[model samples]
Target: MRTLETIIIGAGPCGIRTAIILKEAGVDVVVIEGAAPGGKINIAPRVDNYPGYKMISGPDLAAEFFSWLNDAGVEMIGDLVTSLTKEDDLFIVQCEHNTYKAKSVLIASGTKEKKLALPKEDKFFTRGISYCALCDGHFHKGQDVLVIGGGNTALKEAIFMADIAAHIYLIHRRNEFRGSNKYVKELNDLPNTTILTPYIPVELIGGDRLTGVKIQNVETKEERVLDVQGVFPLVGQIPNSTYVKIPGVLDQWGTIPVENKTKKTQVPGLFAGGDILPRDIRQIYLAEVDGKMAAKAILAYLEK
Candidate 1:
């Protein structure tokens, strides 16, 4: 078991930002990441909202952040944390490869992509269904693909796929898109993309591989089948807090309730930030702010 002053349980913006602050303050800390460092941001095709950068690809921005982390000399461990437990005055973080003991712990695990609960959706996962267009779009070059959802993610995925895929079917349950005007307009301008509004996915059609999808009109009971080789469901995200079973800490939505200013959780010495923290605006800039706030609060708590 390794002992540390603090353990940050993610390598996303929040965790990386927190590590930078703590390291600059001369505090000992280590970051643990289950996958590659970027988290969900890696899948985003383009990010236009984050301040300081006008229009940058998600992977590029993530690379810049990782460069900063390296310059700050923050140590990162590549392992999945299985459980976190409070033991006396210390916190025990159990990972797949190692165990860590720390005076304080920060849970910034972020959110995981939500899946469309259509029949056989799980069976076709990564076989023909995907959540990341940037990651899987190349596989379907010049092929037909269907995108689900009406939010920014869905629109962005469609826009990204329009370049690689021969034709894209953008499906949404609502008549209007909930994404930004710029993205919606960009998607509409694409010649290879077709928008299907007021429709819901009924079933996936294929065996061992995805070949088509069954959809229905929300207003009317009319159903139709789309001949597409791939499907990308960009609906929404859920908090990655299944391993965090601390009673009275998580809300009904499985998000951590923390002070807006301090980012301190109800549990002593346990903090949360980023998407895992309950907040209406879930953005990378806000996640960075949460990281700074949590770092300051953790430093203050360590002094006492």
Candidate 2:
């Protein structure tokens, strides 16, 4: 049972950035990650927004981030944090493998993809229905696939699958997409992509594996079935803050409410950053900023 100065959950961009800043300031900090170091950024195909690089793939950016972390001598542990409990002045973080005690904690677990609550969705999670097009798009190469949603993620997934899948059926509940104009234009330019607007998914038609989907037109209430081997639903995401249950801290959306400047939550020693915070815009740059602010606040608290 090694007691640490601070424990940051999730080694995504937010956690990684926090670790670098704290380590540079001579703070004892450790980052706990469940999966890979990149988090959700790995699922993205292209990222043109982050400063410095005009256009770079998500994996490449993630690699650079990891390289910086290594050079900074930041410690990262690969483990899934199950829960966080406060015992007197110290916070206890319980993971599947071990438990850790820390004076302060930063929650940067990010968000998980939201799923379509259609029938049999759980039965075919890995069988044919998927959320990440980059991860499962190769499996549906040269075959018809369906992409649901109208956000940036959905459009990106459709565009990435366009090259792999023989035909891409993009279904959206609204006629207009919420993604950027560039992505919408790019998706429209692809001859292999078919845009279906004002349509909602009714049911998932398959047994063990997904074979097709049943959708209905929102206007005329017309129902139709699209034959596809794979389905990628990129609707939205839910914050990963259920593990840290603090009364009166979480809002209605389950996001931790934090002061924008300091990233401090209602609880004194607890802070939050990244997608887990109740920020309108969730981006890599903003998450990095939040991490830096959290690290500064923690360092000040430790000094006091």
Candidate 3:
């Protein structure tokens, strides 16, 4: 087995970010990606909320991250981690190809996006439908858009789109919002964003690409037509920790639990960050921050 100081699972923003930091610190780090290196970030059409660029494509940003990893002298291995176990003082990471050993491990595999069961929703993903507003909002500048759900994430996406889109149609099945009052107020303040309550989406409209949505008022039994260029589904996030077993760590609504302040997990040598770990905010910048924090924690643990 190949030995290493740290092993990063998942090639998403968090894993990639952690690898860069460790490599720059002269720490031995190797990245193992289950799928392509881009992971979920590539599904986005465009991203504008990240610090540096006013607007940049999601794939382009991911590419830049990859470039940064290579420049930092980090090595990447394309393999899915099937199992993880502790052997003596080291951790055994098992993949289909081979087994690797590391002193510490960082879990950064973000969750997969939950989609509307509608047929066209999948076919038009990234083309007309999106899951991340910060990543896809710029592509819809000055265009009418529809936001699904009435939770915190939904309202957050609505507020983000209100700034870039000409108009927004906020649809929710219930007459209430599960999101905090502050966010609800912010989204409600947008003149261009119209909130539709007690409305259920029957199906996504359009054939080749998403053009609009079909919704029905669940309480009133009324239907309405809202024309839109894109539909953003911000229902919620499901974590990527189901397969791995580590005691003392809990998952809330399918998200891994961690110490909020330090992003440290219950396990001594294992840490988690980004969307997979429990966090209030799941933005790109915050995800990167979580990754940095986790890296620091790992460094500290290793030093001890």
lDDT of model 3 at position 303: 95
Give the least accurate 10-residue stretch of model 2, judged by summed lDDT: 241-250
Which portions of model 2 show Cα errors greater than 4 Å? none
Write candidate 2's Cα lDDT for 1-304 as tens digits. 9899999998888899999999999989999999888778888888886789888888888888888889999999999999888888899999999999999999999999998988799999888888888788899989999999988888888998999999999999999988888999999999999999999999898877889999999999999999998999988889987888557877999888888889998887889999888765778998999888999999988887
Give the Cα lDDT of each candidate. 0.90, 0.89, 0.81
* lDDT tens per residue, model 3, 13-126: 888888898988889899998877766667555565577888777678888888888888899998888877777889888888999999999888888767778877778998
**Model 1 — which ten-residue stretch has the worst lDDT?**
241-250
Clashing residue pairs for model 1: none
Cα lDDT over the full model 2? 0.89
Candidate 3, TM-score vs. the true structure? Answer: 0.71
lDDT of 1 at 19: 94
- Cα deviation in Å at residue 213, candidate 2? 0.7
TM-score of every model?
0.97, 0.97, 0.71
- The count of backbone overlaps in candidate 1 is 0
**What is the per-residue lDDT of model 1 for residues 1-304, given as tens digits with 9 covering 90 to 100?**
7899999999889999999999999989999999888678888899985778888999998888889999999999999999888888989898888889999999999998888888899999888898899998999999999999988888988998999999999999999877888888888898888899899899899978999999999999799999999999988789988878567888999999998899888889999999898776678988899999999999999889
Q: How many clashes in each candidate? A: 0, 0, 1
- Specify the highest-lDDT model's number: 1
